[model samples]
Target chain A: MKRRLFICSFAMATQLFFAATLVLQPARAGSEDAKSSPTEVRVDNFTFSPETLTVPVNNAVTWVNKDDVPHVIASNDGLFKSKALDTDDKYSYTFTKAGSYSYYCSVHPKMVGKIVVQ
Target chain B: MAKNDRFDPSLSGFIEHDHNNDGIDRRGFLKCMAWAGTGALCVIEGGILKSYALGSQKGSAIRSHKTASFSFVQISDSHMGFNKPANPDVIATLKAAVDKINALPDQPDFILHTGDVSHLSKPSEFENVDQILKATNKEIFFVPGEHDVLNDDGAMFRERYGKNSKGQGWYSLDKNGVHFIGLVNVMNLKAGGLGTLGQEQLAWLEDDVRHLTSSTPIVVFAHIPLWTVYPQWGWGTDDSTQALSYLKRFGSVTVLNGHIHQSMQKVEGNITFHTAFSTAFPQPTPGAPEGPGPMKAPAEQLRSVLGITHVNYVQGRHALAVVDSSLV
Candidate 1:
């Protein structure tokens, strides 16, 4: 009986060890995603909310149009460009390098925004 | 100023027809609007606004080309740096328009470039337009298009050409007993919506025309159509009705616009709305294809589709003879 009890405890210990390993593996990935998850820039009221955003290099930034009109996103340095984004439309671009990128709505020139990837 | 005497078809009989006929869907109405590309010339006669196609000869009762007191040329949507399949050589076309204006039988007193002076809003693009338009040598007045205000909120445009403008590049001037109002409506465009004049600009416009005599002839020019042309493509203005309310008391009012890349005209009460063709490229007629954008016709037909407008205002008669001739 004692031998059987010892075997059961050993099995339990192995199972717990494997479960802990499985949990830790995803935990690391989850933290990485938290860093790289796309940051959002809302286009509303003819202005970009949080006109300036900072993200890690290679992170993705998504611009979602919340206004009723259409807007196009084009970077000043000609790094990224988007089609006419109508209401609720979204455009995302991932920065491969770190630098300051200025963008404006091609439809509404005065509506400008900036993004810093570091 | 009674509604019954108003010249707007919508206020007269068209609105009634629109409601009574269930078969005329929105698409059908848009199909009618497509013919607006033919160009509508709004003429004020006997204190009533009337619009007819520029080439139509049916209006013999009101036809009077006897004399024109003064004339001006309107060139719009030059899009200087635009290089696309639709129009690869925007500069050539703009130069052609300038040549046409220069060769007019009578040199236009001045030139009114409605908007879209540049495509990418680059300094070099504006410079290209400046060099080309210098050939005309006529006093030029400009209002900002959405494209012109792109990078610096029109600070560069204001610095370069809009020095005399009021807030956001809107202003008024008097020329030969006529009041010309240059309005900026493309500043804060609504999403998937038409242009907005904003409350501030509207208030200023109200005050600007408040003290003017009812007999004063008014000419209001902007980038977008003051009337609702096509809401689906943001072709019209949002608060234009309010802005226009101030001018209804005037005996003659002519509103000129550009941005649809095609010509269209409408007459409502004392207001005569006329849109001009772009010097860069032609856009699809409203509801012609899927939507409004750069439309490439046969390469040979490009010049025929693009053109400039010559407007002649008679002093006492209040008759405006608008001639739209192609660059070809």
Candidate 2:
């Protein structure tokens, strides 16, 4: 009986150690992926240039306004409004929820662009 | 005043001299005389004469009369703070527009500003436009161009201009026998550089025109082109097809817009889409280049290129003649 109890305890310890390792591995991998991912978006004349973009959830996206005129990084559902970004100005928003988000420049209605967060 | 009008007292001397100088190689002299005659004529009309000599050609002067017929003046893309080569003083050009409207022999019932009253959506810019427009004696209606709503959640534009407006300042009014619908498409733009009317506004527009008869003259105004002008430059609206779908039933539809800062017109069925020129500057023609920005011209030729659009709506006819006249 004593031998059996010792073995059972050892097995349980090993199982918990492996479970902890499994959980920690994803966290490390996420950090690594973020380091490799592109986080900056360029807002140029009348376009987001890259019409569709994919980024990990919880990762931040920074939009840099490269046009001479002003632009707003606003979500379709009123999720965000970056106000007016002048030339070379920047606005950053993090995606906490995983979903496709669309946005546009409220000033120039025709100037529309979107982003997808996964 | 009647004799001065017909005789053109300023040209009386030149006409008399050219008639008598027949012995001086009349044909060659006529060419030189014509050149000299144009210069002398400028002093009579105004010191600032456009060299294009468009004014020299005698066209029937526009006859203005105050009748019950509905008329409205359209002013778009004022760009008040713009100080670029396309136009140096946008404010001055706008002032000239106001003057031109006031000087019209028959004053319009109202003035409609399609959008882009300010260059950067700044409060000061709005303030400047307000002060200048106040000089006019007619009522002014406005819609936002993307530039005017760039900052402050469009608070500055709404607070100043949206007092009686509905749903982000989008509303419709009945003037004479026409229905005027002002729409907002710049609220939420989409990727691929397309203008959006959003779901809410689209529903409202559908319902707004539901009760009206198909024979009613409908005039829809917005900042972005309702039809595709140049998608590459972000000049076209994404859901414009949805908007135009509703108006397909109308007998006479006119869509007036301003954003591209150039003049272009298209006629589809009963709908006529016209884009106005910017009081600020001119952009490159579609596909002229890979990008869109203020296009500079020779310094002396700038004003002649950047002009205003004049529209005449004749009663008892569906024909609308639009003429774009430069400041020069």
Candidate 3:
């Protein structure tokens, strides 16, 4: 009886360990996905060609200012600020939240662009 | 020759035939002949000869010599470089407007161009506008519209027109007992929103109007509507109240703006706000689903829809009449 009880306890412990591992697998995969997923944006000619962008939550988005003029990648919602990126400069931000983000060039207010994290 | 004769063809024809007649020298006879020929040609051009002659006269018929009465014309949204379907050649339309102003019986004291002188703020675009406006006899005043500040930092506009302007091209001038103020709100536009007059400019504006008496006639010109014309497309100014509050004490305040490419007027107590139609193209009205572009109408209706404004300020009376007339 003692041996049987001990075996039962061991079996329960193994099952609990497996359950915990299963629950933690997705969390680990989420971090790995964030590290691997990189969404790129190109800014050119006083406008962001794809002015409206969409990306998966936890993905990193990069803005490359390919134009001669300087631009600011700033979110109105205060999510990020790429302080005055000059020509050929780049800025990246990891969007961990899911929502629509509207941004504009602080220097040139007429220059506006948006991003959607889902 | 019969004296006091209504039709003495024989006498006149003889005078025409003879190189010298009635002691009028050969050169005098030739001059009279040229004048008579031109008059006859003008008469033949239209049935209403008097009206035609008066129509050829330049400027507004509202005389400026009447002591205590002065007038100026307002033309907005010329959009000179725009070659879209809304207007094939805005320069030609602007020329037509200039001709209209020139044909007025009394020339305006000066002309005010509210904004959007160029479609893209391109150097070539501004240069073209400069050449065309130079033909006009009246002095021109300008303020920057959102479109004109699109590509550059308003360098092209500042270089060309804003010689004596201050603080993002806002300035004030006094003419004919009235004060004129030009404001710059199109520089720093907001997102899915209205234009903005920054804090510094607002402070300056407050101080500028503080000294003026409540009865002073104030003419305020800007690109965006000081009152909310439409908020969805960013047609209104964000801090217009802060600007308007300064002018509220003035008895006669005229607010002029352009951007939506349509004519609209509103009167609030002592203030009268007016928007002039574009000389280029017509945009969709407020809340139209067309997404802020030149709305092409039926070919027959295009000219009637596209129009310009004529502002006449009667001195001492505080009466300003703004008439909108179409190119067609």
Summarize candidate 2's per-residue lDDT along B216-312 as a digit string, tens digits: 7788999988987777677888899998899888777888898887666555556666777677766666766435776665555555545565555
Which prediction has the highest DockQ against the true structure?
Answer: 2
lDDT of 2 at B168: 80
- Reported per model, the fraction of native interface contacts reproduced equals 0.05, 0.46, 0.12
- Residue-level lDDT of model 2, residues A3-114, one tens digit each, is 9667556545543443333221112212344546647778775678676778886555677877666777767777666757766777666555579988766655555666
Computed on alpha carbons, the lDDT of every model, listed in order, comes to 0.72, 0.65, 0.64
Minimal lDDT window, size 10, model 2 chain A: A22-31
Docking class of 2: acceptable
Instruction: Give the TM-scores of the predictions, in the order they appear.
Output: 0.69, 0.68, 0.65
lDDT string, candidate 3, A1-117, tens digits: 999667556545543443333221112212356557656778775567689989886566678876533566667765566644645667666565689988886545556888898
For each candidate in turn, give its C-alpha RMSD to the true structure in angstroms: 14.1, 14.8, 19.8
Tell me each candidate's i-RMS in Å.
9.2, 3.3, 7.5
TM-score, chain B only, every model?
0.84, 0.78, 0.78
Arrange candidates by TM-score, highest first: which order? 1, 2, 3
